[model samples]
Target chain A: MSLLRVDDLRVRFTTRRGPVQAVDGVGFTLERGEILGLVGESGSGKSQILFALMGLLPENATLDGTIEFTGSGPTMVFQDPMTALNPYLTIGLQIAEALPKGLDPATRRARIVELLTRLRIADPGARIDQYPHQLSGGMRQRIVIAMALAAAPDLILADEPTTALDVTVQADILDLFRAERRDHGRALLLVSHDLGVVAGLCDRVLVMYAGRIVEEAAVDDLFARPGHPYTRALLATVSSLAAGDSELATIPGAPPDLGLPIAGCAFAPRCAVRIERCIEARPAFRALGPGHRAACHLTKTPGTES
Target chain B: MTLLSLHDVSVRYRLAGGVLTAVDRVSLEIAAGETLAIVGESGCGKSSLGRAVVGLTPLAAGRMSWRGQDIATLDPAARRDLKRHIQIIFQDPLASLDPRMTVAEAVAEPLAVFEPKLSRAERSRRVAAMLDQVELPAAIADRLPHAISGGQCQRVAIARAMILGPELLVCDEAVSALDVSVQAQIVNLLQRLQRETGLSLLFISHGLSVVRHLSRRVAVLYLGRVVETGPVAEVFAAPAHPYTKALLSAVPIPDPIAERDRHRIILAGDPPSPAHPPSGCVFRTRCPDAIALCAEAEPTAMALPHGGRVSCHRYEPSGQAPAPGLFKEDPLGTN
Candidate 1:
């Protein structure tokens, strides 16, 4: 059975200008021990979907559809480690704040130690006394992960976990996540703008654009053959060291303004392979294969000469 | 001939505790119209090297010659004049640009710096043309930095830098802050601009991928020293340095399936403090290939049999044989 299911999730924010449809009819399910990558550009609404699922949406924002956290409540690890943890709070105290109900102080303290050790934080005894600022960026992020894991939740929703970290530090944090998911059988909903992170960590990828799921596929199939033009454009910009010889092709123009009602496809303006039907009407997502799907008029017929 | 050449250049900061050598005895050469990328994780002195080349920072040691003339000997006014031929683009556009100045005024400032006697109309025309070159709409001329999007602001920054048609452009993490999609656009723009203007670039970045895409040749720095330098294709295909191999192994590929199967060369610890780098080989502290000799003496860059250079005692012919962990099988065919 799927561990978490977000069905037809819709999130809209009311602003002075107008209502912005941030996540429009987004639906996906996460199975036990599976990692799904939510990939998109800034303001593409991937964050909003995660927020809506966590029931952390702002008062001005309205959400529709069901977010079923089947096994356990999924806790989130935020992007910026600097602001995520309280400066004054000790690492131990901060982690203990997430302990489940009915746990005594002794039990909670033990839980904190176990989590800190499990996350491979050096010197859990001395480290717990230190504050967030006392730790390195990578260590602080691991503390954030440990705090999230203290809940003993079935799943983790990490939003750009390694975006602010250095390359080597990023590699370490990713290794931690992979290790945790493998050992504990914890499912993950990894949201990030870096294609490399998604490519290395995720089992399935759901490409979001202008608040809708534009494409979804298994990682291997998507990388091997991308049916959607947007996905292809995104892959070209990865700056692969091995694939350094090929010239890059960038998707021109900025993403569409969600405040203004989007007519036709959201990626129509920037898509290089746009058809006449793209600008006139919205494209419904069609199942291309067992797990592959794309919301594009051109990609409707696989390998078709559009 | 090399357009810009540095001979054992070093920079140090006079801190309260002691002298901090930010850039240490770094020697490099940039040929005309070539993109030479200096890449490493933060604090490796890539930015300091860029600053030293452009004379933003004081050179503690060595000599920097630009087109056969020593830059350090130039007068303050002449140094300002030198900016016309070599301009710099900082990492953050929002921080670099003056919040008070409009987009036009910012781009025009460089023009005024280079040609103070030019008429206002001519200056505005030049600024407009530069903006056009970067593909920014003319309507943004009146907008302040905060009013425009991040991508547009970066374009304005690039336009401002290129208004004088500088021969050498030093970009320090220019597109690192932008979204992946936006990063590609700016990189493509820079490539086209370089092609048309034949501008040489000193691109400083921590991102290996960006360096691979934008650089004709690559230099890997560690602890304020160059560990490897060579053509991008040759070096990336078969990196001779252990540091370079570890760095290459860490780049996250876009496809998850391939990523699952690939072996990552995970370094055990954070890089040693640059303030007090390890004795002998700077990388010996964390290097898997470290031997007794590695900790006793520093390694110098030696030309590899394969096209490129590497700084490692193991790779040095005078040194001992290559250790088991010292060398990696080339993922990219050496041939």
Candidate 2:
């Protein structure tokens, strides 16, 4: 069985101005032990999908979707380690509480230390007694991951876990995830705006834009052959050391507001190769290859034309 | 000519129990129209250094001189004038901007403070023109920051920072919070403005790719101290410091083939706390090439054969660093 399945997911919020269709329609699946990436810009609804599944939306929000994960309650690693962790609680108690109940105090302590060591936290013994406020941002982030993994859940849902973190720290976090997948074979649904993180860590990717999945493919195929213009534009902006005097290729306009009604393709306004049909009609998500799909008129036929 | 010079600058913050020195003794210079990137892991003091330059944080020690004058000790009138010449764009535009104020009002406040003599009509016109330069539509001038998009709000922030035609701009993780496409837009806008205005830029960011694309020179910081500083091309091509090599290799490149083949120099353990920084060298706790001298005494900044400087015992005479060619070539290929 697939690790998780999400179908026709929709999320909306009742704002003072109007109703915001935060997530129009998003659908994807996660196989066992798979690392699937949800890539999008802010307000593109990538993070919303995770929130929708976690059922953590506010009173003003309404969700319509099916998140089928039969194993157990999935764990979540939110963005911003500073705010995600509680300031008042000690790291040991927080992580220990996440463990299965009925364990002896010694086992709980040992398990917490093991989890901390897995996150590459030095002095786990002493750190267990410390509070969240005492650790650095990097160590705190690792603590956040440890808390998430404490339950030994089969699936992990992370939202922008590595965004804005330094390269060394980010690499360490990525390494931990890779090790988890290798040693335990736990499935992960990672959301991030950084293309580098997705390119390096994810096995498959789902490109989201304005509350919809614009493209989906295996990691290699997506990077090698991006089908959607939005994906191509996003990939082009991934600056490299070799970029010399050349201007970064930016998408012309901003993402459409989710509050107002979006007619037809949400990305039509900013797309470089958008056709007349793109502005008038929403394109169907069609298969471009065995495991690749994109919701673009140009990509409908696939390899035929740009 | 050097537009700004910082000598042994340090920024310290006082906590309840102790004094936390965020930025250690660091010195550097920026030429007019040049972009210098400050990069490091979190808590490495890149932001502190940037904040100190823009006067947001007071210097605990050392001097930041602009045009041969100490910025911190300048006269009140001179300081106010200096504010016009030096502007800053923070990381979060939405948080930085006043929620109650419209885009035009927020961008116009700087002009009102510095050039109060301008008529309302002239002020509005200049605001509109600045918006156009940042590529934000004039129609949204009356809209609140919440009503506009994040990318648009960032454009407004850039517009406000550039309205004074400042000689130097400090971008403190300016585009780090934005989406990739939006980040690219702001990066391009900043580059375009720099080209048009010839303004010196102190670009503080952890995003290496953006740094590589924007900066002429780059400084790698570790535990509030600079481990390496050099020309962008030379540093990335052949990093002299072990910290620099690890930092460059740590960044994930957006290429699948390379990702599979590349040998990442993954640093172990979390970064050491700045409050209890290791004795002798700040980076000695994590430096892969640390020798006995690294733990016994501090290594001063030494000029490299390339156009940069590095602080590492490996470069000193009689120093023995066991690891040689320990790092694999960066998969991004420093071409």
Candidate 3:
């Protein structure tokens, strides 16, 4: 059995304006030691899915889904370490609080230092006693990761963990994540808007748009051959270092407003290969290859009638 | 002609314990209608340099000249005129713009300040034309900044910056907050505006890809110092400094094949504090090729063969030069 399975996850937020369907029937599964990347622009419900899975959504948000896990519940590493960490509390106390109850003071201190040291934080002994403000952004992020890993949860959910960091620091943080996955054999669900980050680290990828998974494939396969128009456009729009002085291909229109009712396909308006039928009926996921599927009217999946 | 030039410009902040040097003796020149990018990580003084260029942050030492005139010696009247010629666009467009004001009012305020003699009707006409130039719909003119999308607000900000016909625009992470597609749109728009108006741009950003895409020349910053500065293609293709090479290698290429095969130069530790920066070289503490001399004395900026300047012990005459392969072969190979 898979380590974790999210079946038909739907999340809606009740606001004064109306009911906003943040995540509309998104579903995926993760195996042990797998790094699954969720790629999308903002408001595409990528973070919402992770929130729902972690049971950390706001009171106004309602979720309907079954998140099955075979081991301990997942712990999350947030995007902004500055805000995620408590300013008033010392780093040692913050990390100690994440540990289980009944641990003695000395034992807790040792564990905190160990966690920090394992994350490659320089001079963990002195750093543990310092407050969040005393450390740099990169060091604070490493502390956040240490807190998340304190429980040693089977699954880790990182939502744009390196988005706020500089590229150099970001590369270091990514290396830490890769190490965590390889060393601990833990499953990770990484949510990010950066396609380069996803392509570099993820074992598999799921492209999200308008609160739904538009496509799913192995990372290498997805980058090499994107089946969905939205996925292809997203890949092309990324300004790679290799692409020199070339006019970037952009998806012309913005994402649909979630508060409004979406009919047929949510990405159809922005999809270049969108057909008339795409405006009338929502396309279902069809298998293109083993462990690969895409929801698009233009793509001809084998054994599926057009 | 050189539109703006900085000679050993330095900016320092008075912190609690001691003084913090944000920008340390940085010098570069931006020509008319040229885009020069200052690329660095956070706390590398790129934004500080941008603010200093526009006179937001006071310079502690050195001189700045605008069109061959000393900015420091400029009288109040001349300084005010200089402000009109140089404008800055911030990272957060919504935060930079007034929330209560409509888009039209925001774009027209600059004209109201600089060209008060113009009639209201002419001002409104100019506002509409500027909005049209930025490609924002006319309907959004009356809407508040919060009602519009981030991309649209950025266009409005651009319109506001360009309304005064400024020769130099200091964009401090202007498009960093936008999505990739929107970022591309804004970058293209800036390029088009630069081409049409002959405007010079000092594009300050942490994103190397965007910097490479938009700027003609690039300057790499490390802990408030300019480690390398040259033509965008030259600096990117063959970075002479160790810090620049590490920064280039750190950025993950979107292409899987390239990203997987590329060798990364991962630095060991975080950037040192600017308040009590290391003696001699700011980056030598984290630099992989640091020598004993690098700790004793700072390396002065030396001219490179390909046209640019690099400040590194390895490039100095007495110091051994890095392997030819390290300076010539491009890490992100030609596609």
Candidate 4:
């Protein structure tokens, strides 16, 4: 059985302008010990979907469909290390707070230290006494991760966990998360705008756009053969240090306005190899290969798969 | 001949207790119309060097010459005139661009300040032309910064910067704040502008990938010093300095399978404080290659066989090489 199942999850905000359909009929399943990458541009409803699933959205937000955690509720780790943890609370106290209701203080503190030490947090004993402001950005993030893991939750939702960190620190953080996930057998939902981070951490990727899943594939397969035009555009858009001074060809147009209700494909306007059929109607996500599916009108036929 | 040259240019800020050497004696030269990226981690003085070139920060010592003219010696009026030829695009578009001004007004402000004789219609026409060059919609001219996305705001910033047709564009972490897709859009746009205008770009960024995409030449800075500088291809293909190699290895590629087996040159400690850098090499404190002599004297920036410059004592074999037991006694802690 899947550890978590999100079915037709639609999130909307009742703005003064109109109801903004942020996550439009998005669906995905996470297996135990699996790392699922939710990749997309800003305003693609990536963070919004995670927020909705965690039940942490703003007061005005309204959610539809189902977010089923077959196990326990998924604990979340935010991107910004400084902002996520309370400035007033010590690392130990914040981590201890994650302990289930009515847990003895001694047991909770012991578990906090154990988690911190395993994560290779420096001066585990002394660090427990330090507030969020006392630690480095990377250390603060580790503290947050430690807190999230204190519950021993069935799943972890990391929203751009390393974006605020330096490159070297980002690598260490990824290593820490990977190690923890493997040891604990907890599923991970990694939401990041950087495809590179997704590539490193995720087992399977679900590419989101305009609050919809445009493509879903195993990481290796996705990089090797991206079926969707939007996916192709996104990959080509990345500037690599290995590919020096080479012009990164970008998707020409901008992302569609979420405010305007769309009848056709959300990425149709920006897609370079878009077709007439793409404009008239939205395409269904059809299975292309093992654990690979793409939502595009162009890839409907067997011969059209790329 | 080099378009701009910095001979041991150092900048220091006077703090309450002591002096902060933000940019150490850094010497580099930018060839005509070449994009030279100054890449480094945070607090590495990459931004400070860019700021120094624009005369925003007073230099403590050394010389900075632009087109054979001593920029430091230029009068205030002449320095004011220099602003017309050298433009800068900041990292955060929202922060850099004025909230009150419309897109057109923001683009026109450069011309309004520099070339005051141009009429409102002429300025408007120029702004529209610049917007077209950046591929921004003409309708966005009337909109405020809040109305547009980060990518569009960046285009407006670029358009404003390029409207005056500056020879050198100092992009300080310009695309770091943007999303991957948006980053690509902005990077491509910047490259296109560079080609069309033949603008010499001093692209400053912590991201090596973006630097490799835009820069013909690259310089890696650390604690206010240029540790390594070379052609982008050579630097990325195989970096000489340990810091450069570690930095290159640190970039996460978008592939889970590849990431699992990736070889990372993970440095143990955080960057040392720049305020009172360690004796000898600034990187000696954290360098895996540090030897005995590294702490005794600073390594000179020397040219390598591959045509790159690295300021590591190990790279300079002829110099007083550090003996063994260098880092054994004083190994830096990760914390």
* Candidate maximizing DockQ: 2
Per-candidate local distance difference test: 0.84, 0.84, 0.88, 0.83
What digit string (tens of lDDT, one per residue) describes model 3 on residues B239-288? 78889888887887776776677678889888888887888878899899
DockQ ranking, best first = 2, 3, 1, 4
- Listed per model in order, the count of residue pairs whose N, CA or C atoms clash below 3 Å is 2, 0, 0, 4
Q: On residues B150-221, what C-alpha lDDT tens digit does candidate 2 reach at each position?
A: 888888888999999999999999988877767777888888999999999999988777787788899988
The candidate scoring highest on TM-score is: 3
Model 2, position A228: C-alpha lDDT score? 91
Q: Which prediction has more favorable TM-score, 2 or 3?
A: 3
Per-residue CA lDDT of model 1 for B129-244, tens digit only, reads 88899999999999999988889989999998888888899999998999887887788888899999999999999877777778878999998999999987667766778888
Worst 10 residues of 3 chain B by lDDT: B319-328
Q: What is candidate 1's lDDT per residue for A1-306, written digit by digit as tens? A: 689888889999999988999998898899999999999999989999889878899999999988877877689999999899999999999998888778887887788888988887778989888999878788889999998888878899999999888787799999888887899899899999988788888889999998999999998888887878888888866633235444465667888888888879999998888888899999988777889999999775556455
Q: For model 2, what is the error of residue B322's alpha carbon versus the real structure, in angstroms, after optimal superposition? A: 15
Can you write out model 2's per-residue Cα lDDT over A12-63, one digit (the tens) per residue?
9999889999899788889878899998877888888888878888899989
Off by over 4 Å in 4: A100-109, A239-246, A301-306, B14-17, B316-335
| Interface DockQ of candidate 3 | 0.62
Q: Which candidate is the best by lDDT?
A: 3
Model 3, A1-306: lDDT tens per residue?
Answer: 999888989999999999999999988889999999999988999999988888899999999978888987599999999999999999998998889889989998899999998889988999988999899899999999998999988889999999999888899999998998899998899998888898889999999999999999999889888899888888777744236545556779789989988888999988777789999999999888889999987787778777
DockQ of each: 0.53, 0.63, 0.62, 0.44
Q: How many backbone clashes does candidate 2 have?
A: 0
Which has the better DockQ: candidate 2, or candidate 4? 2
Answer with 3 or 4, whichever has the higher DockQ: 3
